[model samples]
Target: MSIAIDFNHVVKKYGDQAVIPGLSIKVKEGEFFTLLGPSGCGKTTLLRMVAGFNSIEGGEIKFDEKVMNDVKPSKRNIGMVFQNYAIFPHLSVKKNIAFGLENRKTPKAEIERRVDEILRIVQIEKFKDRLPENLSGGQQQRVALARAIVINPDVLLMDEPLSNLDAKLRIELRNAIRKIQKEVGITTVYVTHDQEEAMAVSDRIAVMKDGYIQHAGTPQNIYHRPANLFVSSFIGRSNILNATLFATNDKTEIVIHDKHRVVLTNIRQELIKSTKTNVQVCVRPEEFLFTSDTNGLKGKVQRSSFLGLNTNYFIELESGETVEVIQESDIDTLIPEGSVVYLKLNQAKVNVFNEDGSVNLTEGVKNDAAGEVQSEVNNVAI
Candidate 1:
């Protein structure tokens, strides 16, 4: 019984400071939505409002068309999994999971059935009698998940549940969480500052900054077609280039700092408009094609590191700006620190920004570059 969650012009304030100002977004029923941003950016505050831990100063917070601003957290039937595994150290796994059901005065036999079902769902049935102290971090997390979900909550809220685990375990547990979430079909709202984690798990992500949602879309849309300079720089490693854009004979041409020229012929006709200032271009580390011959921008490799699957090269462009290039290492070769090389920008996929850190939708408007990565991943055949 998942319900859609909506924030209608929501605002949160502390005395004189506004934390979340005029924010409006919706999470579909049974959708895995994420609030992704850096620290002190009010993502957690917004999540708290949904969980009934904080008071909404203005506007409405709705669950399935019902206003929930004054609803008690306990009455909301929402389950929250906190950052720390928050399980009872003295209680066994079975007792901890059954605690919630017991509070509701559920029938003894029904409690056993539900508890047993959740344990198996979380794959922790074998450790039913084990205490939280006796279990591994991953296992304790599983117990925490089991406890939160055993009551059949309608909306599942997880706040940085995997932040304390090691990198290897983080990946493993995140995948497990996604799988388990899908199995339950609970409306989920996950919060994390980790960009890769958000992209990996979210069906859609909202990039927040300074109490404002800068961009909101699918993971592919946020990464490949960022709405502004902050999003481009924050979501991933992007080479931001200052360029001038002008049109001649209905042809859009962007000159990099008015030096290197690249013709953009694929910009959407409706998005093209007149601009008054220089444009900022965003290109990912993997978007640059490297070659020995000077086919595009010529630069010298300032440093290179072999990352097993991909080789990371820090190249200093002739324009005196440093750009990072990530190339897949199919070949067993290396480019020394001071080698000269040529790199070409995949312009069709490039994102252009206005002077005010907003995207220059007037150029390269759609998410075409996202398709390029799909082919790259498909080539791996796994």
Candidate 2:
């Protein structure tokens, strides 16, 4: 049966050096949860902790209601897939998948039945007779996947499983992995530094930095309403601009570059009550619209690149800052360099940060599993 996994105040150390100093998060049952961050951010360390490969120093790790702190790696009933395809070189594809069942002393007929079923599930029935060395990289990964899931593990832990494959194979295998995980209905914890891969397959993501979780939410939530400045810069490309927030009576507005004025309607009430004035604004490239009106941010296009569906423009603002803007490709003509353009921002979609850029002032940001607000915003019920 699939089970929910929980980490509460988990700590890890190497001699006297602390690596993960108390972390917490919950993975839902039968859900695909991803740990996303740059290297040395403790994503793989936390995954190992869950799999019983690394020892926990404090708090508790739980699979449903059972504490797993003292459990052995083999006793955890979990399957792990790594970046390097770790299949047996000597075993055929079918034999590799049937290894786990045979070790458990299953009936001979049952082992053959299960192996055939899993071969078909992973779509490697045709390659069952072939050895690992004879299969393609993609096919070898399928063998690894089939071997891991043929025993019906309670949970699946994958650490950068697709990081070794080429771009095209990565997409193909990721789609297959997601489909198979859903079909088998097993809870999964996946770790990767690739933001796009996390966003593509995860039901939810936990963005971590230096052993701390920066933000945890759906891909749409994290991309649209990031919890902090770091998360805003990490998830995707964005342009940061210095701005001033002024509240008078019941209205609040932000002034950018001492010229552009944007009225904010959905910001939290606490921000208006605070005495802060200076703020940072995060505007995505797609959020900027080229306007013909005179009352807009004036800029000159330096260069533009045509990227199939969208064209990217590098514009130099009058204040000497350069920003990237993306617009739909026009079949008519491309805007020439040195052409003066006015930009109007989509006020409703922009994220505003405080002076230190530590917390997001935008509303509807959700809290991580630790129940603490990573940003100064209203909690969104997920």
Candidate 3:
């Protein structure tokens, strides 16, 4: 059975410091939800509250329709996997997984059956008799997961469970966790600071800052259409160009760094309607194409680094502003440092931001640009 979680106006504080304040969110049944943020963002605190490990100062937490604010951790029926694989060194893998069932006073036959089932589910059954110290990091983590899920809890809470493993092992274990979750169809809430991990695994992510949520959406929406400046800068790499709104009767343009101007098509209509004082143009590194044509922005390459699949160049514009550009070409034909090049803005890929750094570009604008880029993709394919 899957569980849905609802957090309504929840608050947590330690004396005068508020870890979470008036926070509200809902995790759908059987969904793999993630709370993503930097350290000290209150993600772990919120997870603890849901597990009944932390007290809620205000509001309430609910599993399905039952209020959980006063519920004890044991009564919450939540299984938790922690960062450190908290397995007993003395106990073998089978005993570790069976500990939770033993605590609940499960029948001897039932406990053995369930423990064997979860061991097979996590694919670590071969090492059931081995002690934790004898198992690899990944093997031990699987044991920890088996221990948590053996009791068949309604909700599973994982607090950076992959943090202790090496990078390769982290990916391997995460994939295993996702596969098992799908097979069991259990409701899960995973908390992590690693952006790539969150992007790869989450059905939806809530990006938090300080004690509040900055934005909550699928990976695509959060990456492509961030709600604010903090989110735009946090989710991924972006080049923020300071610009001013220059509108004319027929069109609108932005004066970049007071030296150059770029015409805006679909974005112009919205900019002309806004009353904000400042504007910024956000361009990804891959959006700018290098051209030999004189009409584009003039820049001198300052440094270039080869990154296997792509070459990254640091280009200094005529106004002394530095920007990074990524190209998928060989380093042999590299634009050497101090070599002049022209950079053409792939206008369709650009995102405009208001003074507060909120993405002002609407879906209509994106669709129009996608229509234009569709032909470009086809031409490349041909």
Winner by TM-score: 2
Model 2, span 309-381: residue lDDT tens: 9999999999999999999999988999999999999988999888777778888777564734442344421
Sort the predicted structures by lDDT, highest score first. Answer: 2, 1, 3
Candidate-wise lDDT, in order? 0.83, 0.89, 0.81
Evaluated against the true structure, the overall lDDT of model 3 is 0.81
Where model 3 places Cα greater than 4 Å from the true spot, the runs are 247-250, 265-277, 358-382
Residues 1-382 of candidate 3: C-alpha lDDT, one tens digit per residue: 8989988778899998888867877899999999999999999999999988889999888999999999899898889999998999999999999999999999999998999999999999899999999999999989989998988999999999999889999898889999999888889999999988998888888888887777777888777766555666777778888778766677666777665667777563533554333587777899889887777788999999988899999999888889999999784687788999998778766777666564455233221111222233223210
lDDT (10s digit) by residue, model 1, range 1-382: 9999988878899998999877887889999999999999899999999999999999899999899999999999988899998999899999999999999999999999999999999999999998888899999999999899989998999999999999999999999999999999999999999999999999888888887777777888788777667878889889888888775565777788456677777544454446434677788999988866554788899998898999999999998999999988767688889988888778778876665555545342232222222233223210
Stretch of 10 with least lDDT, candidate 2: 373-382
Question: Residue 292 of model 3: what lDDT?
Answer: 78
Error of 3 at 179 (Å): 1.7
Q: Candidate 3, residue 191: CA error in Å?
A: 1.0
- On lDDT, the leading prediction is 2
Q: Where does model 1 exceed 4 Å of error?
A: 268-276, 292-295, 362-382
Question: Best to worst by TM-score, what's the order?
Answer: 2, 1, 3
